[model samples]
Target: MVTKTEETQLDRLENQVDNGGGGAWEYLCLIRKLKVRRSEKVLKHGLSILNDPKKRSSLGSEEWTLYEQVAIAAMDCQSLDVSKDCIRVLQKRFPESKRVGRLEAMLLEAKGSWAEAEKAYSSLLEDNPLDQVVLKRKVAIAKAQGDISGAIDCLNKYLETFMADHDAWRDLAEIYVSLQMYKQAAFCYEELILSQPTVPLYHLAYADVLYTLGGLENLQAAKKYYASTIDLTEGKNTRALLGICLCSSAIGQLAKGRIKDDKESSELQPLAVAALEKDYKQRAPEKLSLLTTALKSLKVSS
Candidate 1:
């Protein structure tokens, strides 16, 4: 989701300070800004700064932020001892902090101490029932424990309070999909589309789920969503083009002599075929013939 300029900046981040230079704060901040996860590098560069008393002292109050980043990175890298040390520093400095309590709970989660983690999260929630992180952690615990139903319940409860949470909606949708609950999954995707109408991911997901539902109306709706995805992506998305072909073909066969709208679909199918063929030719010339053979087999009428 970064611009080309931001991508260049990301590529340059590793070379910022000899891989252990004085640019640790800038490097970490840039990674945060980009929302990238270079956990091992984060832990390495973070500790390089933290280990040097002079550099660590230079950060003033920002040192605590680095500690939090390093703690999370340590957990990601499976360096539990490093994570513990960082968390200990934070906990000692701010003993009754809810954020620190979350870090402690996350540590327990990493250690597979589910009951303890749950208890910790539960206690944190007692103070602020709508703690979004803690509530999501409960869902994560359910997922980690392979309790799909429990995860669904926790996500549903979370949604009741935080309906605007796109990630939570997405998580719930995926879990439903895994369980072969396409109808329920479709509902989640609809909410996502409603919340972020311009996001092609939600459109694409909604299309796929609708297609899977396998009805004339659903296929038609799926086709419209697929078309929206293509439009939103400016036709650069190969998957959306492929979805168009699949939906058009399905709709054609199912409506062969049954529907009066065959003429409208007939025009759309050829356009989809042309788009797909052009896409394959430009990106994978050798695959063009293979794609052609496959499209011919679909027999999208007209």
Candidate 2:
């Protein structure tokens, strides 16, 4: 696990490299380790090491990894010429490598050659049917080609085999949400929760979907999930707090008769309102009056 101190050191190394100091290899490795998207910086500093014979040789077998890194970074910055040079070096060394093949496909992708890229990725998948990266690249190709339905289909097929792939589930869920398919999105979130129950994000997302597909039962369920999020975050999540207030008020409205069991929602509303008021007072005093007015309006309507 990367510590806070390691992260601080990366920052310091970044500044050091920027000042024309050495440690180019250290800085580049740190950026890759942290998965930081300093694309321009990567291109600038990475080439510095690659261009110098001594520094390049110091990496030895790791020189290939640096080539891959610089290639991807160059593509990100649209410096295709540099990307091609780096990729050629890798291809010469690891000609039959699927990893290098992915780079070639990505270069095709960068040049808007969607058809060629798709073909390249498909060939890669044929050799290794369960290749997760290649599968995702296919989905990305569909998206880049403006084929939303195709992207959805690709993602669904990808999920059938890669059921444990939470990132794929998230992408599919967002696609469903974008198309206003709340129930489908809700199902995706449910899968995510089952896969990782302790993650507050899945709980919060499921709550939002249930709230969107609203009824008394859904609102009540949404409130419970929002409350769970507050508990998980130790009451620091402002949006989840607001969600609780909204769900409570909506439930209160739906249960107008204020039946015996429904009294909890009536009480819940006040607690959520108090939490909201306290949060706004501490975080954004300027917005407190507006929040109060909004709460009062909800009360009046109910």
Candidate 3:
């Protein structure tokens, strides 16, 4: 009584099973089809067949592949409980398989069981201590739980193991900046620049930290970095350039006050005026007027 369309659908479902014979992808596809058709009896049959040890011998070379497909499908469906059960079965069947621990941890994380997730990740790290992804995940978890010190400890451990990771160094620098440790952040940014001189964002971060530290001695250096950032980024960052000009004007004013030489102070006056005019054009008139007065005072003093 089935129509041609219904018959075709059933044929497609049957084809999903590897009669050649038996694999994880085949079983997973069959299960998905059964689930979609609401065939509870068939779905239960499939599950029972998967759980039976006697059927393993009959499953041939495709048994492990079928099992992995089932695990992945369960995870994709957000069926954490099912995924965990499948992973446990896999570990029991293949105790020496290296991916079981990772699968178990991923399922635990999906279920928001943080303590169990930590234990699983720690076990992985203990086995493979040099895995950067595992180390970064641990640091992220610590930071998520508001354990900044713990995150820093993890970062320090990672640094001790592998000192050349520019990404990790940038992450640590951002963390320090978040904590308002400007000087430490500046030092970290310096290290990052040494590792990756071409990354404009790192240069911008370095300039921001220098601006925060309130020292004009570094203003010229900050300006240079900001200019480099703008040039390398193809003039795409107007805000950074504007910030640099503002800071430069302020530093010029400070320099004029500090230096006793009239000629040197006079030289700073024109640079400060130019910076102020650029800032004014960028819609920062208040700071622009302030710098204009500073430039006028420098010219009169000279």
Candidate 4:
């Protein structure tokens, strides 16, 4: 269902078409093409409209917004020259706009000017300390430059304000994982689980972290979280099943210090192994040898 605002816009587009406003009709078609991710069409139509000095000038104040749109579409189409042309026009028109500053920073980054892009982003942040767009760009620039520590710091700062941003948490966790900082990654996954306990990916990630940081205690926690993942995904999670096998094997190895293994431990290992064997037979027969090797490495009999 089209919303009232979109209906109004469509009505205006129809009126433009009726009045022989070919430019408006073209612009509407360009927007629709963009909506459907037809980047080539956007570049083709946007360039044709932008190439006309009369139509471009006639747009007046609206021209800047059109320039920004065309600039982004051109960038998507790898037409950097056209994109830069649009950006240059916008820079001249909106010299003091922070939004324009961001576009300049993006253009700089796209041009492989890492240092200049970072500087531009920093300048933008200084001008408006709460600029989320600039902050995000700073994080991206840091990551692009292989400054993982700097990217993590920037994301942490962002999360201090936007604590509920799951994507930020996930990004930070992935960076930590890249650096082999499993404990730190686990902390991020913990936050995700605390806030969105029902998300299977968060549970699986947390479980994987705990398993990677393995001691008997951490493995036990990993087993429990992997169980949660399996439950959340209706037991169709192959990775969770494998995690259960590994965790159970590790726990069984640790059980020599105790009088006997716990009841869940006694029950879970057989079930996980059974499920894994069944899945291997049905979906991935070629991987059965690899699965057997992994199970053997964990001292679990297949």
Measured against the true structure, the TM-scores of the candidates, in listed sequence, are 0.90, 0.85, 0.57, 0.71
Flag the better candidate by lDDT, 2 or 4. 2
Give the TM-score (vs. native) of candidate 2: 0.85
lDDT of each: 0.89, 0.88, 0.68, 0.81
The numbered model that scores best in TM-score is 1
What is the C-alpha local distance difference test score of candidate 2?
Answer: 0.88
For model 4, state the Cα shift of residue 55 in Å: 17
Question: After superposition on all CA atoms, what RMSD does each candidate show versus the true structure?
Answer: 2.6, 3.3, 14.6, 8.4
lDDT of 4 by residue, 1-302 (tens): 24446667666665665465655535445456434454565566566667888877776776666677778777777788888888888888778888877887788887879989988888887878888778888898889888889999989999999898887898899999999999999999999999888888889999999999988889999999999999988888999998998888877777765847678766888788888888898999999888888888887765
Over 193-231, each residue of candidate 1 has an lDDT whose tens digit, in order, gives: 999898998999999999999988999999999989988
Query: Which pairs of residues collide in model 1?
Result: none
Residue-level lDDT of model 3, residues 147-259, one tens digit each, is 99899889978987788887788888889999998888898899888988887888898988887777666776676677677767765565465555556566667776575
Q: Report the Cα lDDT for candidate 1.
A: 0.89
The 10 consecutive residues of candidate 2 with the worst lDDT sum are 257-266
User: Which residue pairs overlap in candidate 3's backbone?
Assistant: 23-66, 24-65, 24-66
Ranking by TM-score: 1, 2, 4, 3
TM-score for predicted model 3 compared with the true structure: 0.57
